[model samples]
Target: MKPSTSSFNEVKKAIVLLSGGLDSATVLAIATAQGYECHTMSFDYGQRHRSELDAAVRIAEQFHAKTHRVMQMNMNAIGGSALTDMDIAVPTGGLSETVPITYVPARNTVFLSYALALAEVVGALDIFIGVNAVDYSGYPDCRPEYIAAFETMANLATQAALEGHKVKIQTPLIHLSKAEIIQQGVALGVDYAKTVSCYQANSEGLACGQCDSCLLRKQGFREAGLDDPTPYAI
Candidate 1:
């Protein structure tokens, strides 16, 4: 959707972390709707689901982001997660109450660090991420506390913040349930079909319907009373 610019004399810039996933896509739509000129960033962090990188590009184009950048990093080198390590099988049985094997070590911290640097470079005081607490795998980093702590550190560590330009880490989907998130995205014209949330998506972006991510996505659509359009490999 076109960014709303009526309220501002000049459009404010914001950095959006796009993972080519449902949540991130929704976050992008929300950011645009709030009148930010979004600079979309995606990571090539050596994950098995490389197809999401391509999906990120498509989402960025559709959202008409001011700039789309894919940063390269080899998370596989330090891999403890199923996504970055091919040897580890993704758990398809169900979601776990504890942190799952899919939780990459300090992944969100690393991603946000890069995003923070990018924000400083681009003169953006806001960084948007799509981390959810409800209807999510129990990743510690996705919790509200973690985000709050990160934001606190960001303000202290950044030159911008020291200079009185405080940085705000935006988590629009953090408190929302999956169904609520989907409904909001729909209202903002986000095309959920284009997003790739599968933990084991094939090269063509067809999802393995059994993964935890797929399960949550399917349930989200069902709960929202919307038909899921994701292409599945099941």
Candidate 2:
């Protein structure tokens, strides 16, 4: 459903980080459901699966976001992760306790910094991100403590916050399992088929069905008792 149209002065604006993944798509739905004039942002930071960038565009249109911006940067220059560096292989093995090699260095931090800037310019007090500590690969930046720390820094670092406006970093999926996240998204009428969650998605946005991301997404659909509409290359 589309967010209700309101006058600019009465609009409740929010900047949503849309990665063209299941979680980010769900977060966009949540922000829309909350009656926010959503401005979605996606990054094309030299990721191997550039198909997700296309997916991001589709998702923003599907959700009827007020605005969608794609920022281009070269994270591959400092790449230690398999996602940004084609040389490093995506792990098909099961999840691990330690941080995986798939983790992009300071990715959320960089994304949030950009979001904070956009929020200031758009007069959006809330910045929505779909970071989950539960049902995720071991990414340090996805933790609750990290989000909290960043929110504190955002308030201190922004001109909007200096003028008595507080910036909130909203992570609605932070505490929810993948199953719960899927359920929420389905309830909000999110089209899972439009989202690409696989770390090594093909040019057509088809999942590899072997990477850590694909495994988690599969499990989430199974647990949610929903048929996964994600197109798989396997």
Candidate 3:
């Protein structure tokens, strides 16, 4: 018997920016479950924490992304952030009103630019990003206003938009707290152990446990009443 095909069979293409982090992993699961043929993208941007890229590749495969591309670019050249430059230290003091040292200058903009290009070429009108304002490192790019501005710019920049195909930038995890994101991902059967969100993960993929990223992740799992599966190099 043939499986019935209707609106349920209609799957749209989407470009997902996968960072191999907890939030991004959850975003991919959400996008896939929503019936998008997800094309995942990650950047090898000379970040100090390269282990996350390896995690990204694994998560993409696990989620059955239609395609996954890891692009090479040197953000180290334009470095102002701790993640890109070893000179600046990743803050462990805690989140503050000011953006932390780990905020890669224009990083999300650059990543979204690449995603927009891919979306245009692939005829995907939607791009999914896993940026969350809550329980985040306070990067300016993660704000909702920033994302809205980028979406406006993306629609204007694309020729497809001029031809009536409006591109939408989707941030499924935007307003959700870290605990909520983790809970949702767990419900979707996401293996938290497989995802790495540490600012400076070791070669073996163990988290530093002191960086802001690790602190936030640990806090989230604690708040969610879930055991943290991440290995830590204390």
Best by lDDT: 2
How many backbone collisions does model 1 have? 0
The order of the candidates by TM-score, greatest first, is: 2, 1, 3
Task: Tell how far residue 227 is off in model 1, in angstroms.
Answer: 0.5
Q: What is the clash tally of candidate 3?
A: 0
Deviation in Å, model 3, residue 124 alpha carbon: 0.6
**For model 3, which pairs clash?**
none
lDDT of 3 by residue, 82-110 (tens): 99998988887777678888889999999
lDDT of each: 0.91, 0.92, 0.89
Query: Comparing candidate 1 with candidate 3, which one achieves the higher lDDT?
Result: 1
Please identify model 3 stretches exceeding 4 Å from their true place: 1-11
- Against the true structure, candidate 1 has what lDDT? 0.91
Cand. 3 TM to true fold:
0.94
All candidates' TM-scores?
0.95, 0.96, 0.94
Clashes of each: 0, 0, 0
Question: For model 2, how does the per-residue alpha-carbon lDDT over 43-137 read when each residue is reduced to its tens digit?
Answer: 99989978888888999999899999999999999999999899999999888779999999999999999999888877788999999998999
Question: How far off is residue 10 in model 2, in Å?
Answer: 3.7
